[model samples]
Target chain A: MEKKTRVLLFKPGLDGHWRGIMTVSKALSEAGMETIFFGFKTVEGVVEAAIQEDVDVIGFSVHSGAHLEWARELVRELEEKGARGDFLLLVGGVFPEQDHEELREIGIDGVFGPGTVTAEIVRFIEENLGRKVSG
Target chain B: MEEMEEIRRGLEEWREAKKGWPERREEFRTDAGIPVKDLYTPLDMEGIDYLGDIGFPGQPPYTRGVYPTMYRGRYWTIRMFSGHGTPEETNDRWRLLYEEGETGFSAAVDSLTFSGVDPDQEVHGAAHEVGKEGVPLYSIRGVEALVENLPIDRMSVALVVEPMTSAAVTSMYFNVAKERGLRKEQLAGTTQNDILTMTIGYIPWGSLKPADLLKLACDLIEYCTAMGEAPRWNPINFTTYNYREGGIDAVQEIGMGLANAVAHIEELLRRGWKIDDFVHRLAFHLSAHRDFFEEIAKYRAARKLWYRLMKERYKPENPDAYRFRFHVQTAGSSLTAQQPMVNIIRTAYQALEAVLGGTQSLHTNSYDEAICLPSEESVRLAVRTQELIQEETGVANVVDPLAGSYYVEALTRELEERIWDYFMRIEEMGGVVEALNTGWLFNEMSKAFNKRRRDQECGAERVIGVNCYVMEEEEPTPPFRTNPRAAEIEKERLRALRAERDNRRVAALLDRLRGVCERRENVLPVVSELTAAGATLGEITGVYREVWGIWQLPFVA
Candidate 1:
């Protein structure tokens, strides 16, 4: 039996925009990935959960324009736990195109902004994880 | 009747003649999936009586306009919803908009404020979001700074907060007004105390139960309008605009709004209030979306339906209760991030729809909003978009200018019936509160979200920059970043407030609030005093959460 790629997604902090994250979760699940959507969690909590769940990818969405702050916090949390290189970290939400490089520099593997296609996200996950997800 | 018969015969010949000409698509439909015909004539409006169905403005069945003169008497207030970084920065932005001819002000609060958490709270990473989404009004000091040196006494202000913190936040503003030597009777503003906004639209953290939210919402209406505390203030605005931005169409938008309004009305009436007490001050905030004619017809249908609902059901003796006055905002969901300049043209056309629909107020979205908060230049352009419609365009000169158009009138009648049917479906499911508890409203929102995603992906709904006319290698628009020290500044403000205010007094008032919550009485009077005594929103909402308990949403991913 093929081991399904596990992905953990959440919303960091108190930002309440849920549609984008929920859509991505459903898309990844339909794409044959085991998605665990922890609705709202702290970066530290998400990192601990991802490590415990043995997820291949950890993703979070932010629409509160604090994307840089959140991205940095998540990376710091992962580094502090010695799990920075363990999972593919992804950040997606309503942020500026100019901030994509800064987000990537903050140790995020995937950065999806506004008008992102769900298929593009699935492809990014599959390609980066070194496995073809059969949907 | 003879004219209708002749037009019916003419429509049959025209339909046959049009069969030879190739149409643009196999089918034509409005954004709401209502089938559209190639042409409409008097036959389409045969049963719609002008006097009974489409009466003149300021009369029953206000299909034309809410007021008799409409924009001819005065232009719709250009009330922009804006806030960022800090209350001081937001006040500066308000001054800029006012200088640029904005008539009203709306405060958009940050996530911490929205969720009733202060920046200094121990909640996870709460400081990161302080003053990020909007201005942080945690205490009365922030509220005072937000309206400092502004003519709030004359111009109306809107506090875009939900029921969770509406009582506390609104009271903060009211207290600010009072200290500035203004009476509550002379104050005019709106509180976006819509229950569905938190439950469905944005889904704030630690939200109260649907029934408890209803109690909080009705508490405000009972305080301001029914109790005559702030007689001129609009205590609650049923903001369907927030919900519509989640991808619902025109029919679902108005349908949900009507059902939501009914929930509040029933709650207030149950609390021993007359129909005329609060219904007249019940305003709406609707969206102006892509469908030009359909959006126009939607405003008309909404006015008529509100009139019909009031006349047939509540029958408030106050004539103003039947008027469905609304503020229209150009659809934020319709704007695309790619080729952002095109959003300007899109906003212009939607603004025109609102003007033709006879909106009482309007807010045009900035072109760069799809990406980040609007820059000063971009927001200025957004204000100019509405200014162009009022100044350059002659559309607002006449009231409901398209009132007699065959397609518009027919579509209005069609939409009125469809909206009523959808509203009844909600009513059948035990109204808005029950539907919310059963997760039925969330299901509707999720369904709409998926459908819109699918439609856009498959090119069924062609967004100019996203799907069609794609632009590659475009220069990124310069993003407007909020103040980096906003969190630190807001935390300092809270710290200072705590040191200065009489802690004993605040604690005693909080105890009173807990008792009020236990008795399920109105929380306004005590909350007003608490805000004056420098109590934070987190403290006030904390009491409610402790007493009522937080709601666990029946949400599934």
Candidate 2:
């Protein structure tokens, strides 16, 4: 049997809107991924969870229009931890369509905004898993 | 008999029209799981008494509307939910919205406010929290700045806050009102005092536990009841918006809202407040979801069910007690960042549904909100969305335009029955507080959410931009730049306020609040006095934090 992919979903901001992440987590579970929701964590918290959970994917969702600052800080946090590019790093929630490329430059692996189908997300994770192992 | 024969012949024609329409691939149920038949006819609404089930506007059941002239008498208040960065920034948004002909002010306080922590106390270096989500209000002075220079008498101010902070936020308002020479009775505002919303595990913790929050909610309601006959003082807007957005369908939203309302009513009744005294002021913050008919029928059925429930069960003497006056906001969950411009159409339709469903007020989400906190241009455009509907479209000429439609009426009836079934299930768990605590309520929400997820995954549902319609390569929408220094500015203000305030006096007032808490007396009036005496929001909320410590959702987290 193939090993199940473990994904840690972190709400990396204080925005109390949870529908996006909750829905995505549900989708990941339905797609047969092992999911952990680190409810409302800091960037450091996200990086720490990546180490602790030994997960294949880490997705941060920031909806308060502060994703630029949050994403930068998370990249810095990962670099400081010497774990940059160790896992598949994804970002979601209320981001402009134009920022997907900039997100990749800033060390994010994939960008999933609102209305991106969960099935597509599952596929993204599946496709990205080998990259994490090879890296 | 002739009309029946004409309907039967029309039904045959409808069936013929629907034959081979190529819609087999579609899901056949509302989000509530009620099957959507190909055609609804007189047979669908078999025994619904028009007058009894769908009452006239302003009459029993109130299926049509709460007011005789819903928008014609005047329009529903065009409210845009606004708060971000500093109180100064939020105040700027308020001024702009008010100047742009928005009618009401809804305050969205920051996350620290929800936890009863002052910015200085807890969030010093938290980059994301510096008014990123909402204004960081920590004291009487904080709220004072938030509402500074507003025409208090002309506009109804609604605090879109939670339970534990109700007393603190209300005190901030009362103190400001006193400073402005306004009496308690002269105030008109609402506090989103539904702790049941908190228990849905949306937020990890509120400042207080479930039981404490309920007592505080009852206290605020009773405080408003005692305040002399000043109309429009909405004490509580029982919210199922967050719950529904959390994945529950329309039926559960109505049912949970009804159950939470009754739970408050029961508590207030036990405290010896007449149901008529406070029930008139009860309201709802209902979500306008994507299903146009389901959303419309949900609002209609909510009002009718509440009326019958209040009349038959509690028996309030005032007719106003039965009317479920709700403020609707477009479902934030329905917005999409892909082709973000399409969200404007989604919001317009949702706003129209709210207007047609006879909402007392409505808040339309901005097109770019799926990307961030609404930019100024987007918010202005959102405000314009409502104006276009109100001015351009003649939707408001008649009240409840879809009142007699066989499909709408059938949906409304089926929704009402299912809502009652939900109510019974809720009651079986001893009531809302127990249901929420025992994970029973979350279980229901989980089921609702899981069903929705399955539907989305299996292509049973189409979210336009999300599932079926492919925006192969999305154009780059404008990026939103957040104020990184908002935290420092807000904290500096807090520091200056703390320095200016008389510490000994503030401590004494908080001690008095603690005494009031111990005596089990009503907490609002005492806190109002302290706020008027120049105490901070953090100090007032600290009393609660001290009393309750911090509440944790052991089941989910």
Regions of candidate 2 where Cα sits further than 4 Å from its true position: A1-4, A41-53, A72-86, A97-106, A131-135, B1-27, B122-127, B204-207, B227-231, B518-520, B554-557
Once fitted onto the true fold, the runs of candidate 1 whose alpha carbons sit more than 4 angstroms away are B1-6
- For candidate 2, lDDT tens digit of each residue in B460-533? 76777767785674555675555668778877877887798787887888898898887778888777777666
TM-score of 2: 0.91
Model 1 per-residue lDDT at B225:
95
Candidates' interface RMSDs, in order? 0.9, 3.4
Q: What share of the true interface contacts does candidate 1 keep?
A: 0.85
> Per-prediction DockQ, in order?
0.84, 0.42
Q: Residues B1-557, candidate 1, lDDT per residue (tens digit)?
A: 78877888888888888878998899999999999988887777779899998989878789998899999999999999999999999999999999999999999999988999989988978999988889999999999999988988899999999999999999998899889888989999999999998988898888889999999999999999999999999999999998999888999999999999999999999999999888999999999999999999999999999998998899999989989989999999999889999999999999999999999999999999999989999999999999888888888787888988999999999999999999999999999999999899998998898889989999999999888999794689988999999999999999999999999999999999999999999999999999999999999999999999999888743
Evaluate residue B502 in candidate 2 and report its C-alpha lDDT on the 0 to 100 scale. 81
Instruction: Give, for candidate 2 chain A, the lowest lDDT window spanning 10 residues.
Output: A126-135
